[model samples]
Target: MELRHLRYFVAVAAERSMSRAAEQLHLTQPSLSRQIRQLEQELGVVLFERTTTGTALTPGGAAFYHHARLLLRLAEASREAAHSAGEATREVVDLGIPPGLSPDWVVRLLGLLRDEVGRASVLITEANSAEQLRMVREGRLDLGLVHERPLQALTGTRLFSQPFGLAVRPDHPLAARTECTLRELHGLRILAHGREQVQAAHDALIVAAHERGVTPLWRFAQFSEHARSCAEATESDAVVLTENSARRLLPQWPWLRLAEDSVDLTTWLIWQPATRTVVTRVAEVISGLAEPVTVPR
Candidate 1:
């Protein structure tokens, strides 16, 4: 019935343990349990199934969990909107950027934000696509640059599409090649960003390599610098990176385009539909920078 009850339920659903949720909520276990029981009694349905391991959501609980999260998000957004309206002296926008994004794009975005947003200050956070999506949905970030399309009901503007490529050290045999086939990557030690960080790109690479009968030893890292270091230390034959990232991070090395025609690397500018005016202007500036390119992948 109350917002606090919804918050408690959400916390319990997330943590899956009464004690842990109580600790997170800063409430005693008994009090939290009592509140949950009151909520279930009011709703006339069981929410959580008690077990030795922890708590598991019942069917009713799972449905309620989804709606509870949405309600909480809407409440937070309302508060933020009111706060922003009250403070007319200055504006602040929170933006999220994924790792290994092209430096040039970041520079352009920052320049546009400064020019269009006037005196508004922008806070930048480095996060993966999934993390950015969550932040945007939870009202923590006003905008995000992500590699994958969001599954949620958020607005995403398509940016330029990047072509996939392989980055090889100058000493590597493949470095001299203008283009490399996925089949040629077999038996090579490869490095790339982890799937959790860039799920779509990583999945595309895996599928393309598998189709070509190539299964290179994959070493994954969260950051491009770490991937590069691992590749150098292990004498990796190549690192799978976008053409733009390779040019920026490893220009000294040779970047060979992948011959696979099915792989596409695209970046999207994502934000909630009800974003603020300043955030909307920022997104418009980014959208005007480049039209969506159709890479023949």
Candidate 2:
């Protein structure tokens, strides 16, 4: 019925003498005998044939011997395996990253984590903020880096803020400006991502225009790929993100420019108690790298 009973039975069955088994198991003979009697009672079958020479297994005892031995060995093996996995898990940390985050930040975060934790084995996943948040909650991810406003249910530490602006080809007239007002390009096409946030961004820009007594024309690009495609297309005065996204694409696409005026964005790192140590170390590394870099005001 219980593991201890199985242990006592296996020991007695292997030794074949209650006296010898008790000596080996460090128990009194009567105590061992009582345990065997209890085990037989629970199973409703006699296990041992008592003889003047020694104890022998009954027919039922022989059959149960094989199964009980296997069960005991399997239980031991499971405990060992679980212990090994737990040891490895203690040294590993998994992180979930937002899909649109720059590869540079991802690489930086991983390198920092490895150096900080030494034995850290990192697993990385790329998903949207919503998906990453869910993964963190479900314990599939230890932490996440995202740009959405922090949910009340989830605690987060803000990392950095970036401005939103138009990305354009170098040949575009707006690209040559040292600085320009929103009204200068009142009727130009625009590209942007996000559903509600993009709309919010648009409204903010429109409000900026209204403050300057001008109206700007725009269209929404729901994904980064679409925004990039619009930027590469000819006659594309497409609205574009003026955020730090440009910094990420600069190495590969060196011709994108920040449009005159746009909103700014902030990013955060989110995690729960289980990931506190790793996240704190990571935040320290990010903070060190995030030194006061100058940006357009």
Candidate with maximal lDDT = 1
Q: Pairing residues by index, what is the TM-score of model 1?
A: 0.65
For candidate 2, give the lDDT.
Answer: 0.67
Query: Which digits, one per residue and each the tens of the lDDT, describe model 1 over residues 1-297?
Result: 999999999999999999999999999999999999999999998999988889999999999999999999999999988888866565788889887776666877788778887756888998889899999999999988888986568998888777778889889889889798888878888888778888998998898788767888887776755656777776777888877778777888899987754466777889999877878887888777655663222
* lDDT (CA) per prediction: 0.83, 0.67
**lDDT: worst 10-residue window of model 2:** 288-297
- Structure candidate 2, residue pairs in collision: 164-263, 165-241, 165-242, 190-238, 190-239, 191-239
What is the lDDT, from 0 to 100, of the residue 3 in candidate 2?
84
Q: Candidate 2: list runs displaced more than 4 Å.
A: 1-90, 196-214, 232-235, 247-262, 273-297
Q: What TM-score would you give candidate 2 relative to the actual structure?
A: 0.56
Best TM-score among the predictions, by candidate number: 1
